[model samples]
Every structure is written in structure tokens, then in C-alpha cells.
Target chain A: MGAEVKQTILNRLIGGIDAMSPRLRLAAKYIVDNQSAFGIDPIRTSADKAGVSANTFVRLADRLGFDGFDDLREPFRVSLLERYDGSAGEAWLDDLSHAGAFAADHARTLRNEMDIVKQSLRLLTPHKAEAAAALLTEARNAYVTATRSSYALAYYFHYVARMSLPHVHLIPRHMGSPVDEMVSVEPSDVLMAITFPPYSADTIDALRLARRSGMKVILLSDSELIAPAIQADLFLKVSVQSHHSFSCYAGAMAVLDSLLHHIVTRGGKAAELRISRYQSLREDFGAYWRAKLPRLRRE
Target chain B: MGAEVKQTILNRLIGGIDAMSPRLRLAAKYIVDNQSAFGIDPIRTSADKAGVSANTFVRLADRLGFDGFDDLREPFRVSLLERYDGSAGEAWLDDLSHAGAFAADHARTLRNEMDIVKQSLRLLTPHKAEAAAALLTEARNAYVTATRSSYALAYYFHYVARMSLPHVHLIPRHMGSPVDEMVSVEPSDVLMAITFPPYSADTIDALRLARRSGMKVILLSDSELIAPAIQADLFLKVSVQSHHSFSCYAGAMAVLDSLLHHIVTRGGKAAELRISRYQSLREDFGAYWRAKLPRLRRE
Candidate 1:
């Protein structure tokens, strides 16, 4: 009764929504979108949140041929509880009817990405990754170099690792050259560089400078042959397979994330501990908003 | 003889490098880092790139007891050719004796990320993803919002899609509230949001605003139940599994990349066409460098 009756009433409201006046239509939209909210919040609260008068909902209820607002709300209240209690979601998960041709292509895109991640992970090779992580960890300073398309991966890696490892830094900081950042680097420092073909000449230059400075080089790249140029001490291969003829960053993304995870693990300092300070500041500064108003009651 | 003599020469130079004068050590460092360059470039060119006089090479050759600089270069030149022709690189790649326990753990990190990508891709459901991409592609404007950890994913997605789709924008533009960026949005717009556990309240606020504005909502989250609150027209689940208890972003990275690929595919626009203009500007602005100094000639 909970599923059937509420769905029927929902269909009736949805079925006749466009024919209704704008006011009733808005009310119907609110009810449909906020069924769980409506089941919990007082109708006045719901009406206020919906930006419509309480009489609008009553009118929508009248239009739907419900006796009144409470008559309209009762079924949804029972349905919301039933939704909370049900295993029916499993059925929805099992339904995989391919809607169209585009869907089939979309599916292939995901499969390709998964395959790339798997293949790339195999290339990372645990021993090499540990040695790579060790170079960064043992260094007096670890300068990360990447540009253009690979910048996001470097940022993600640097942002996470920089939290616990104070010595790690992203080079070419804020539109400056890697030379500017590497200027003060000691011979014992490490350079972790990310690049893929058509590799940026700037990245190669940075790798060269790191070598000249006697810094250990750890490279994440799409090709093994790239190592021939800079002689990267530890090479992490990022497989960038794509039929789209563009850089697919899934491998780089996974490899960098895994490396950062290793950095955090080796540091023995959980990010939560270092991050709580900034988290509290964000809260204090009101950088976050509260969406507590429209929530369904747990009880 | 080329490989063996080159190896002995390299080992001797590396072993006795520290005992040399600062100028001589710099030359050795240059030779070590640019092995192929030393093998291919004119000695004068190598000397200039190494920032040393040609006398430095001749004197270094005298120190190594070679007949001259070219005599020293001959072995490296032959060795470089051998490197290009040999199948020996496979042995180096296969030399994965785990240095310690950390290597084993690092391997697991990669394996875990690969699994997360696989698990999350299955959750995307091809038809649902195609519909999601269509919603974004067809929308008047697609507003992407995420805070904290998920911002990087939104940035990567928005950065890629906004190149081709001018209507796609990241909300809370440069420290503004999502409401401020979303204020001008019409009912035909779409709100794309990313969040994981302990989700940001502001993301939910933006979703609410999008709903109130009668815009379609598409959410990428760690849970499907998230759609129940916002009534997201489409939901793409991101799996954030990690043993260390911090958010793992591989799935989000892969899914968002795949979704953007779908959007580009549906739009029939490759990113390169639009990106070429900025790429040209970068070249004009001298934002790149030349690593052309170091090279192994193709011949």
C-alpha cells in the first residue's frame, strides 16, 4: 500500500501538473521533490521553504482530488518510512537496460578507463614505488614539477603530501619557473616530475636542472623511453591509453594518489590530525553552510 | 666493447667525482645527466651547455687518460646506439625485488585504487551516465560545485568541459558562495555537484537552490541515498574506499574523466580545437622552456 498508493497519487499529480496554473504547479513540484521533507517537516515549514503559501499546497491537494493537505501528506509520510526500511533498492541496482547507443559508448569509456588504471597500476611495481616514495621522504626537499595537462595531477599529489610532509613543494609555484623554486634546493633534495608525450619542454628542463643539482629524480610518465633522457632514479609509468586520441589522466591520477597515500603512510601522520586546524578555521570563517533545514528525521 | 667500456668509464667518473675541482665535478655531473647528449652533440655544444670551457672536457679527458674528448665520446656514442637497439631494458623493468615492507604496501595502494575504479565504474551504469552527459550537454548552463577534497575533481572536469562548452561553469567562482554564482541561473540550467562522506553542507545548499530554481540536478557522490534528498535527476556514485580512512579519489577521478569524455563525445567537439588558442598564447608569453640541449640523435 505504501509504494502502490503513493506512486499512484504521485503519478496523478505528475500526470496533470502542466495543465494546472503556475502556482499549483510550483506546489506540486515542491511536494514531489520534498516528499521525505514533507513527511517530516510541518506543512507551514515546507510551504515556507518552497516559497509558496500554505493555501497553494491546499489548492494543489484539492486539484489532485485529495480532501485536503494532510490527506495528501499521509501517504508520503508512510512511503518515506517504507523507503527507509526497504531492500527494493537492490532491484533498481540490478536493472541494466541499455537505453540507447550513446549509453553503450559511455559504458565502453568507463571500461577503457578501468583497464587503463589496472594496466598502469601494474607498471607502478611496488618496489619501485617504495623507492620513489623513499626518495621524496628521505630528501631535504622534494620539488614536484609538472605543467599544462599534468598540472592537476601534480597539484593533487602536492596538496595531499604537503599536508604532513612539510619539505615537499610544487615547483614553478604561481606562474614562476621551476628554476625559481629549485634555486635554493640542496643536492640531497628530490625532484618528483610528471610528464607525458607530447611532453612539455619545460618539464624536461626541470628534470634536467634537478639532475644538474644532484637531486634524485622520480618520474611519472606515459613512456619508458622518457627515462633515457633524464635517467630518472625511479620511474613510475602512467599508461595513458585512449581511443579519443587525447590524454586520459586516469593512470596518472591513480598513480599520483597512490604515491601521496604512500607519502602520508610513511610520514605516520594522518591527514585528519594536520587538517583539523584548517577545518576548524573554515568553520569559524563561515566558509561552510548548513543544509540542516530540509532533512528527514532519523527517528 | 661499447657497452662494457662505457660502463667502466661511467663508474670510474662517478666513483672519483668528489675528489675533482668544483669546475671538473660540474662537468662530470653534466656528462652523467646528459649521457645521450654527450654521445650525440658536438663536444663544443656539450661544453657550452654544460657551462664549461672545451678545455674542461679536454682536461677531464686528460684526467681520465683518454687520447682526447672525442676518444672519450666514442664509447658513449656507441653505447647510446646499443641502448636504442638492445632489448636489455626489459631486465631493468623486471628487476622488482621489493626493497622492504613499504614496497609491498605501496603495491597494495595501487591495487586498491584500481579496484575502486572498477567498482565505481560499474555503479555509473552506462545508460545513466549517457543521460547525465546529455543533461550537461543540453543545459543552458551547467554549474559544478564541490568543496574540500572534491574541488580538485570538479576543477579537472570543469576545466576540460568548459574548453568546449562555454556554458559549463564552476560555481562559487574564486571564493564566492555557490548561491552568488548560481543566482543568475535559469530553470533550464543543471547543477553538477561532487561530495563524499561528511559531505559539505554548501554542496547540499547549492543543490537545494538548483531545485528551487527548477533546474535539473546531477550529483556525483559516495552514496546513492544522496539523490533522495536533492532529487538529483541523475546520480553517479563515486567509490572512496581506503584502508587509511582518508578519502581516496581514484574513482572520482576516473568517473569524472569518463563523464567529461562522454560530454565531449556527445558535443562532437574535441578539446584541442578550443585549447589551441590558449596554447598559442602560452608559447607567445614564453611560459615554456627548451630541453633541446640534451639529445640522442636518431641516427
Candidate 2:
């Protein structure tokens, strides 16, 4: 609910006599005006300060659609309690203050990430995950590239996907002669590009060139503006905000982990069968394996 | 405190009590044992279930040196509220049960990460960060190599460090010719290697070769087991454990952030002078230059 709507409801409940009994309405008005007093003083004292009887406060609970005053006021009490400031770590109070600020920023970052997840969920087609999975399963060669902050996520996906897929390449960090390796990106291959703000010029250039080269593109970016949504076959935009000037990866990590889990879970049975067959085949070719098997030679 | 210490304290508090307080002591014990139930149910109902009077509960609170029963019970209530169940997503009541658990886990994760940061602070000598800053400030080249899960951290550090020191190079992802790169690594150059389990063999190899080449190494790994501590000039271990089997980078991320903060904060007047110079240089070479430049006619 928006703050405006909640405030309107609160005002009506306090102001409208039809909405509440006379004495109960007065108590509501008192609470609305003296919100800070609730944190510093007890409920009984606050009630006395408001010139309302305890019975009237009980009636106020009924008017607010609560079982009792305890029910009506518990949330407020809890919020106030959370806002309590009891200083500790006396030697490093400045550090403690920064830590407190960081905590608040971290919460905001989580909430922002949650919002991004919800936005992506709303905009993304239902077939996106399945289609992406199909490409992951069918691709001949997969190339994963992420510059700057997004590099790790791409690297992990590449590493894990390589366990099942045939040929996988991670993009080079340098723009030197290693750039020639990317010339092999064909139509059958899938190119995953991960980049976030401030985006690397080289990564964006590489991704653009790869897309022009006709490889299927999957892009993960921090903001939708930089996501390359139109050119990419699949796009996921993850916004991570940090309390400090940097970015938070809590949501990004969660999403990546979930994707890995889903992929592995979906292919588990088939993967197990493939592994079993592969093991049998390995044993069949025991002589060839044994020539290079240092551990097995010791046994 | 250990559970044994807590149990001893409880016994000490109830030691002198004889006939009438025995029931109150039992009620206190019941409160501790059935905390989750108390969080979900009302106080009066909890008293009934424990076969104790409300007065006895109040007396137990008094015996514990609390102002009231509410004060004694609130922490247990909050704790019970925080315990989350994995399967709670399927049902509303189950979700409510799980919400508490999720909150508790979140708090625990924060605590664990902070503990790691404190440990890192203690383990890391003042000379370490200072030496690192000095080397980085003076180095002709700095290469950061982190593969798989540790990639994000490396990239983040690299990006931030590049703002002040532009000679930083992130290692190429594919292990195509790390030897070629290592050939260029000099005694004055710094190589930062970051890896976590299941350890990336490629990163370990890169670090081993870098060490052999006499390049200064800064190592970040999950545990001492994955990559031996001797490979790096400065080796930091950040162990992260979650309820989930796969290790999370919460601890590593926290420590890295703290390290970055400490470097910037403790680098003192020289660092401050360098930062201000960099800022002024950035301003001079910033976006305003496009507007300030003379426009050329298209041929």
C-alpha cells in the first residue's frame, strides 16, 4: 500500500466519529499527534497524557478492528522498539555509526533488488526460462563473457555449464590477440554477455560484434537501459544497490544460485543416466585411461 | 554464552526457591522449552498449556530480575517469531512459521559475516594494508585473477583499484596461455588470486606459476585447504557457511568491502592527496569536455 492511502485511512479512523466511538476517537487523535511519545513512555502513561481512560483505549482497539489494545498497538510498539538506540563499542563509535548506516542501506538494497525481481517477473514471458534452458541443452559451443562486475556470474555459469556441454569458452580479459578466439562464435553457438554499470567499453563492443556475427545472445545487466533487451534472445536485468557507493550482490547471487539449482534439478535424471553410461564406457576403455591415471596406478 | 552457562544461570536464579516457587520454576522451564508455541499463541493460553497460573509466570519473571513477565518473555517471543521453516511457502500458517526462521537466518548470516570481518581485521597487520597500498601505488602492472565464484569480488576490487591505479589487468577467463601472461609478470608486479571451493584448478595453477615467477601474490580463498597459504605474500582466508550446502560469499564480500574501506580510510594524507588529484583530473577530462570541444563539420 502507498503511504498516502495508509495515511488517509489513519486520518479517517481518527477523525470520523462514525468510524470510532467518541472517547476512542480522541485516543486515536492523541496517538496520531504524539507518535514519538509512544517510544519514550509506557502505554499507561501515554494514555494519561492523552486524558483518555484505559477503558476508552480498550474501545479504541475495537474501533481499530483489533481484539484488544495490545493487538492494536503491538505493531507500533515493535517499530518503536526497533528504533531504539543503545550505543555500544565505545572505542569505535564512528565505525559503529557507519555500520548502522550500512545496515540500513543493506536493507534498502535488498528491497530494491526484490523490486527488480518483481519487475522482471512481470515483464518476462513465461517461456523465457524454458527457452533459455533449451538453448543451454542444445548449444554446440557456448561462450560466456562478462566485463567488470558481472564477470564472476558469467564465469560460474560457464564453469557449471561446461560439466554438461561440449565446448565452452570464457571471454578474455585483455583485448589483445586473444580476441581472435571469439571469431569462432557461430550461429549454432550461444554467447552470454554479462555487464553492469559502469559498463566496460570493451565488453559492450565485444557483445555488439558477437550479436552482429549472428550468435544467439543472452544478456544480464544491472539496469534495463544497458540490458540489450531487443538484440538478445534472452535478457535478465538485475539491479543491485549497496549502502556504500558500491553495489550489493545479494539478489544477484540469489538469482544465479536459483538458476543453477533449477537447471541441475531439471536435468538431474538424464544427467545421472548419462554419467552412469559414461562411467561404464570409461571402464570399457580402461587400458587407455590407465596409461595416464596416476592415482589408479598407485592403487 | 554456552548453553551450559545459561543452564547454570537458570539453576542459580531458582536455587533458593522451595515449595511455592517450584511451580514457577517449572513454568519458566516450560516457557524456555515451548518458546515457539508462545510466539504463535497468547500468554494466557501458554500459561494454561504449561499448567501454571499467570501469577506464577509473573513471579518467575520477578525471580529472573525482570520488571514484568512481558519483559522476560519478549526475547523468547521474538526468537520464536524469527525461526523460518523451509516448506512454509506452501501454506500461510507454514509461511508464518518460516518467516521467523528466515529472519533468524538473515540475522545469523549478518553476524557470521561481521565476525569474519573482525577476524580479518585482527589477522591482517597494519603493515599488510599499508604495504599493499604502497605496492599497488607504485606497481607498473597489477593483474587480478579470480575464476568461478570468486570472480565478482576480484572484478569489484579491480574496478575500484583502477580508479586510482590504471595499470590493473584482470586475468583472461580461459586458461589458454596463462604462461604467456606470466612471462610478462615482473618482480615488481602484483598478482591477486581469488578462488573458493570447489577450487578452480586453473586459478590455482595461475597462482602457483605467478609465485614461481617471483611476482608478489595476494590470495583470497575460502579455506587454507583449497589453495595452500604459501603461494601468496599476503594470504587471507574467508570461510562462509550457510544452511544451504553450497558456500555463500557473504563473508568474503563483507571482508573485501571492509578492506577497501580501511585502505581508503587509513591510507592517510598521501592517499587523500592522490584521491583529490585523481578527482580533479577526472573533472578536467569529464563529460563537459564534449561540450567544451570544437564541433567539426561532417565531410
Candidate 3:
């Protein structure tokens, strides 16, 4: 029943997109694009994401024949509830219990993961990556921000980038106040924000703060239709879809890896020297284990 | 030249495997199985990994007609040196420079990741996953630890497990001292250690300390030939190979996901209730974004 209502809402939004005002058009487009997220997220959150005011959301809902915003959101909530009501858990167990079931499931997962990576690659063009890299290269400082599951990508990017460039930082360091961390982000800085569905409020807030501060914002997300993408100077979409409840991150990791490689390679000899120096320092610090065996027999 | 020498060593080990005594056979088996890693790691590390004393490593070298362990390790070191001389970097750049290169590279990475996941699935059978899940279900406390690149897997595992189980802990919390964190891990507790090649010394040290405290260790790694694997009550191998410099972690993540799903489903209603409680609490805390729009038009 809820799924039917969602389908109707989706059909109405898609059909009505042309007749809406510019702001309503943007809201309609976002709703059309992120129907899944729209179903679950709050109006204020979705409004903030779509780069429109909450008033705009209410007007759009009225235009769509809904009694109120809550009515519009009900279908999404109902669908999510149905999804979380244990069917996935049962299917997960059934897949694991039988012979060849595990193998078949694994094969399907691999295929889904591959499809995600392909989609991400198609979305994240090299031209856009190069442009983003140029911004990072030219910026006085570079800051990376991501929350929850997406934080790993931010951390990995910061860790590897800082090895070759000295000005890279991971925001909200040591669980400090994010506002405090963003205070120093100047207009000359580049702020890279990564967030996907169940989009993090903290990350969205950070991106807003960065934009207000005049920093060049590079947004890596699952889609350009997302609200954070609206504020981005450069928006790179990377798919994170998966067969399981949690999203797969391989595509994100690969995209970041490629971006870093471009940055380093473009930086030329200076980057190479810095990386070598870092490697040598790591060796000097005894950071890696030595493989020496005993010499008793030789003696 | 280095490749030839490494190949000769591999052939010799294979030819001599059946003729050796049981202990020597074990050493030979490890040496042959981990030929790639053997070429890079120190002999003592390899010997320790094979569950033999350093003296056995020296004796094996003697039996192989090497002057000492150093001589036996020379080919592997030389091969590693040749590899590190920079062909991979050149190939990486070339792949990124052309049109459709990004798409092609992504496809290859997806294929490689799929292979890794398949290999890991093959290694980690249903029976083995059930045994590990049973241990996790029965444990009084479950602590998860992984560092550097592999840390994401540990974080994801801990995050999801904690949603359904109260006793789950992330080791070395907030990047604090691992030793201090493990001080209270009792015999009834379970320690899950995840590490991969160019493995972190800190994780290995933590695993050793946990073993000394009589905690059961579940080790997740790229290969069973690693030193920590020897001490693992449960050693699960998940490949992390990639065309790029850094390893792909999707395989490890998939394996951990499957393991956790098994645990949750096997734990039945208790796990479901806990998860629901977590979801409800998240909603209550306003941890998620709400979609409420302003009442401007309605008023």
C-alpha cells in the first residue's frame, strides 16, 4: 500500500517537474532523483540538502496535492519500515544455510559491486578529477571531512595525501568540535566532503560552513542530485550500492586512489621526493619489521 | 635475474617437500606457499609464522645448500627490490592518462576485487564461519582491532555488531594505547585481529598480548602464512590484492559482513530486539534527519 503511494508521488513529481517554478523545479528534481532518501529523511534535512528553504518544501508539497509534508513523507517511512521488518535477515540466513547458496550469493554480490564501480567510473570523469586535483594543488591548505562510515575514505585520503603534501588535514580531529576545526578554513583552502545516503548532518553542516567561508568545496557523493552537491564547486559521484544492508565502499576507495595518483603525478618531482623522504623516514623509525633469521647453523 | 632465482628456490622447495622430516616439511610448505611474501619478509618472521623456531629456519637453509639464512633470503629481497624500482607506478599513470582508461581500470579493479572475494569465500567455508559465529555468540566480551588500511573493516564490524550486541568494543579506542585497552580482556573474551601485508607491528603486538592474557583470538588476514595466524584460535584468509599500489579491502569487508550476519541470524530474536532498540534510540535522539516542513501555507 505504501509502495503504491510512493510510486504515485514519484509519478506526480516526474510529470509535474516542467510546470514548477525554478525553486520548486529544483525541489522537484531532488525529490525525483533521491526518492529513496526522500522517503526517510526529514523535510528540514531534505530542504537543507536540496539547497532550498523549508518553506519551499511545504509549498512544493501543497502543489503536489499532499495535505501536508508529513503525508508526502509517510510512504517513504512505511517502505523503510517494511524493508527493516526482518525479510532481509531471513533471506540472509537462507542464503548462508544451503549448499552453493553462499557461492551464489557471493557471485551476486561481486556482480553488484562491479556494477557500482562501473557506474561510479562513468559518473566521475577524469576531467573533473583533474580539475579537483588542480584545486587541491593550488590551495593553501586542504581539509577532508566525512562522518560515520564515510569517514574511512576521508581518513585514507588524508593519510595518503599528507604523505606527499604537507597541508592536508582531516576535519574534526580527535573528535573535536567540527565548528572549531572549520574556523581556520580560509577562502584559499579546499574542503573535500564525502557523504552518501543516510547522508550525515555533520558533513552537510561542515560543507555549508566551508562554502560560507569561501573555501572551494569538492563534494564526493553517491549522486549530483543530493543537497550537498548543490554547494559544491566540483561534484564527483561515486556509487556505493550493494546487495547487503550496508553500502560497499570499494568504488569510493578506487576513486580516491585515482584522484591521489593524479595529484601526485601532476605534482611531478616534488611529490616524488616528498614520498621517498617519507618512506626513508618510516624505515629509519623502525616502523616496519625486519625479516632476519638466526645464524646458528652458519656459526 | 631475481625472478629466475626466486623461481629456482620455489621449484627446489616443492621438489624437497616430501623428502623432509615433518617439521622441515612444515617449514618447506610455508616457504613454498608464501613465495611472494617470503621474497619480502625477513627469514625470522617467516620462520615464526611457520610455527618453527629460528634454528629450524637456519637448518632448512643449510639443507637447501645455502650458506645461511641470509643467503636463502637473498633472492626474495632482490625480487622485492626489483619490484620496488617503479614499474607499477608507471603503469598506474599510463592507465589514468587516456580516454576510457578510468572505465577500463575500474573494470579491472572490479574483476580483481571479485577474484579476491571469491578466493576469500572459498577459504572461509560455511562450517568455519558457523564455528567463528558460535564463538562470538558465546563470548562474554568481543573486542575488534585493525590498523591503517584494514581499520575500516574493523570499524564497520564493530559498528554493526554493537548495534545488536552490548559487549562489543573497538580495541585501542580513539587511537589510544592498545595494551592499556586490552588489560581487562579476560579468558572468556574474544579478540578479533585484522592485519595484512606490510602489516602493522602495533596490531601484531596487541594480538600477542591478547594471547598471553588467554583471550581467544580470531585473526582476519590476507594469508594464513602470517605470524598472527599461528596464534589465532580462528584464522580466516581474505585476499586484498589490487592492480594499484595499495590493497583493495572489499574482500575483507565482505568476509566480515558475512560473519556478522551469521552471528546476528543465529542469535535469533535476542539480536533482532537489540537491533530494534538501537534503531528506536537513534530515532529518539534525533540522530537521523527529520523531513518536517514549515506550516506557512497551512496556517
Candidate 4:
């Protein structure tokens, strides 16, 4: 029910946001971006998180044809109840400010990250991975791309995948934009894009271009409700929740790790031969450091 | 006890490797890396994993002044027992190829990642995070560096840290090696270098330079026994173990998340102010994507 209310609210807000005042638009975007905040925290807390005033919530509710803030929260309340029955780590952590964030408690931090990993793993079930891997293995080429914080995630995936899968490529091969690299892309290719909230324009544009080219896409992101995610051929949901200020990527990396395994499995003997050859090349070229003992080498 | 034995074996191999023949050296290095392979797998399995013959193990042991393969295995067995008693995820996942590898079991992969997260958290401990955080807070500047696969880890840290703490820098700012960046580093600065097995020479050299120039150091790696980690003032151990062929960074990202939280706390009002400003500038400059509904936007 919470998910339903969340989705409904998103649908309405994205449509109505342009008509509202700047402040209302800001609050609406915040609500949409932080999908669970309203369900998890009080209106005041949600407002504070959105960096808007409590009255702004009431006004935004009014604009949405709701009676008041309480009415606005009712759907979320119903959904929150359903959420409590399951969805362990989704809403339990919101601020993490007072106790979890500032506490310097490494154990709590570790637990928070692990919870994210667990939840992300749960969301990205084996079924989804297998489906995604099948798409990847079937594609003639797979291009991965991201910007800013998410670039690291895409880089890691492309780096490791390229070691064995020569067809894998990281986009924006030069310094332009992902769209610049989309020129030669074909329908047989796949685009694996990683992005989170405050999403980049280039990534969305890349997704748009991929859609136009009739290319398959796998989006690794925090939410499936986004337009690109809904349109994606496969969406690997990764929890970006964290104990710190930044959204965590542990779960995203975990998802990629599992996906890579499937690619290897699907690739079979060819993948193994490629991996071994990559290994030997690294060894022969002295890509890795060998143990050096000056004293023993004297002999 | 297992740790002690592992360290002893590492020290012996590093000192004696130069005197061994090529195949013996390969076997020695394989043992040094995949550190627990010997104890966890049988002679045949270990030899296969090492990509060398079983005779290579016996000959390598002979060169190390051990009786034979059994003599080398004894220390590992003792260490293996000790490891089993305490370290939950360490030795158990030596090779995931047979059952875990090819199977498209996302749950097992998730569980594998979570196990790594659990063990990495267990190893990092609250005390270590506090100490590392304190070092990070006290440093006039913190320079984070890594190469290839590990670069993502360093990049994420510096990227997040720079938002609140402007003093943080990602080394090798342009094209030169990390050692080139160490010229201006001072005792007041701290070097946080991330690397794992098949470690990069640039990172190790950066650590060496930091040590020589009186810059404090924090090492984030899969193991604490490495020479660079040993010299580091603080070591935050992260597990790179996984159910896939690649070494997972889920644990490493978790560690960085916790440490970043500590930095935020330690930075206090300044961090809060900087973070808010950074956020607002992004908002004011329209750095983030706002939902656009073309149909609704039609006047």
C-alpha cells in the first residue's frame, strides 16, 4: 500500500510540479526523490529533510487536493503498515543523524551497510540477474556509462568485464558526453547505465538515445519508479541507503558482482579462455608485482 | 594463531622467493596471495588454483627448507583451524568455481557478499574506525590514492570527503604517478591508499614516500599484513572475497562510508555548513535534474 501511495504521489507530483510555486516544486521533488521519507518520518521531519518549512507541506497537500497534512500522510500511513510486515531495511533508516550518523560507532555503520547489501541483494533476486545476464551474453556489444559519483561504479564493472569480455566498453571514450559515443551504437548493443538521485542529464539523454536506437538497456540504480528504469529492458535495483551523508554503493557493487558471475556462466568456455589469457598476458608482461628480496637475489 | 602462521609463511616466502626457480617463485607468490588456498584446498586443488603442478608445491616447500608439501601444509592447517574457529568468511571461499560460480544463484552471491561485509566489519572494529577517523580529522589535508580497480574506492572517498572537507584530494591529479604527487606532502597531511592483491606499484611507492616524508598513513586493503599496511598508522581491513571471479569491493565501500560519517561528525559545524552550501550551490546552479512534464508545461 505504501508503494502504491508512493507511486500515485509520484505520478501526480511529476505532472503538477510545473504548475506549483518554486518552494512547492522543491518539496514535491524532495518527496518524489526520497520515496519513503513521508511514510517513515513525521511531516515535520520530512519537511526538515526536504529543507522546506512544515507549512510548505500543508500547502503542497492543498495543491494536491488533499485536506491537510494528516490527510496527505494517511496513504503513506497505510502503506507504512504494509511495509512493516516486510521490507526490513527500506524505511527503518531515514536521518541516521542523531544516533547512527554522528555516533562514530563502526559496528552500527557496518550493520547499516550490510543491511543495504542484504536488501539490495533481496531486491535483485537471482531471477532478475539471470534475465539480465542473458541479455548481456546475447548482445553483440555492451556499453557502460555513468557520471560523477556513479562513474566509479560503471568503471569497476567495465574494467573487470573488459578483462574477459572484449566487447564491453566504457562510454564517453573521450571527454565529450555519453551521447557523443552513442553515434555508432546499434540495436544489437546493450547499454548498462548506473545513476542515482540528482541524476545526471547526460545519463538520461544516453538512455533516451539508447531507446531510440532500439538498443537494450540495463539500469543499475536506487529506484525502479524513475521513467528510465520503467523503460529499461532490465532494472537491477540497488539500495543506496547508508549511515553516512552519501548514498552507499556497496549494494550496487554487490549486484554487479553477481551479474558478472552470470555473464561468466553464460559465456562458458570462451569466457574462461579469455580470462586465462588475460591473466597470462598480465603475468608475462609483468603487470603484477612479484616478490622481490634483495638479500636472497644476491646469490 | 592462524594469522600468526599466515604471517610467518608470508615473511619466509618474501625473504626466500628470490632464490627459488621461476616455477617455485610462481608457486610461492600464489601461496602468498590467495593466502589461505593451501589450508583450504587439497594439494591437487591448490596446485590447480596456483596453475602449477603438485610437484611445484613440493619443490617450492623444499626450497623454503620444509620437508615436503605436508610440512608446508601443517602450518596452514593449524592456521586454518584457528581461522575456522573465529574468522567466518576468510578461508571458506577459496574457490567458488564448482558450485557457487556457474550457478545463477543471486541469493548465494548476496549471501557471499554479506558474509564478506560481516567479516570485514568484524575486522575493522569500532576502535579502528575511531582511530582512523581521528587521524583523518587531525590531518591538515588527506590525500586518497589508488590504481585501477582500487581507484574507484579512493575516488569515492575523495569525492564525498571534498564536499564537506575541502582539504581532501585524490592523488595523481593529472597523469603522473602517485609518487609524483607526494613531493608537496607534509607530516600534517595524511595519505589514505587503497589496494589489494596484485597491488599497484604506484600505491606502494606512494606509501613509502609518505613514510619517508613523515606523512601519516591509513591503509585500506583486504589484509593488514602487507608491508605498506604494516607501516600505516591505521589500517582499515576490507574483505575483497566474493562468489565471483573478481574481488568484490562491497566491504571496502562500507568501510569508507563509516569513516566518512566520522569525518562529518568531527568536522562539526564546518562540515554542516560546507555540505549545505555544496548542496545549495548544486540546487541553485541547477546541477540536479528536476522532473519535467511537457504536457503539463504547455501553457
Candidate maximizing TM-score:
4
RMSD of each: 25.5, 21.8, 25.7, 24.8
Q: Which residue runs of candidate 3 sit more than 4 Å off their true CA positions?
A: A1-111, A243-245, A276-289, A292-299, B1-128, B242-245, B267-299
In order, the first chain's TM-score in every candidate is: 0.64, 0.50, 0.61, 0.62
Question: Could you tell me how far off, in angstroms, the CA of residue B188 lies in candidate 2 after the best superposition?
Answer: 9.3
Q: What is the interface RMSD of candidate 4, in Å?
A: 15.9
User: Which lDDT tens digits does candidate 4 get at residues A172-273?
Assistant: 764778999888889999999898755667787899899889999898887443332225788787777654446878788788887787787677788878
Ten residues in a row with the worst lDDT in model 1 chain A? A288-297
Per-residue lDDT tens digits for candidate 3, residues A11-44, read 6775666566767765775675455456655687
| Cα lDDT of model 4 by residue, B35-144, tens digit | 44465456777776656678889887877778788778777655544533332232222322233533425445666777777677667655687888888777898899
For each candidate, what is the lDDT?
A: 0.71, 0.53, 0.67, 0.70
Share of real interface contacts recovered by each model? 0.28, 0.07, 0.05, 0.30
- Where does candidate 2 stray beyond 4 Å? A1-95, A98-135, A138-142, A167-190, A200-217, A227-233, A242-254, A269-299, B1-156, B166-193, B198-219, B225-235, B239-299
Model 4, stretches more than 4 Å misplaced? A1-105, A227-230, A280-299, B1-104, B228-230, B283-299
- Locate the minimum summed-lDDT window of 10 residues in model 3 chain A: A290-299
A111-147: candidate 2 lDDT, tens digit per residue: 3433433333223322454466666667777777875
- Scoring only the second chain, what is candidate 3's TM-score? 0.61
TM-scores computed on chain B for all candidates:
0.61, 0.55, 0.61, 0.60
Best by DockQ: 4
**DockQ of each two-chain model:** 0.11, 0.05, 0.03, 0.12
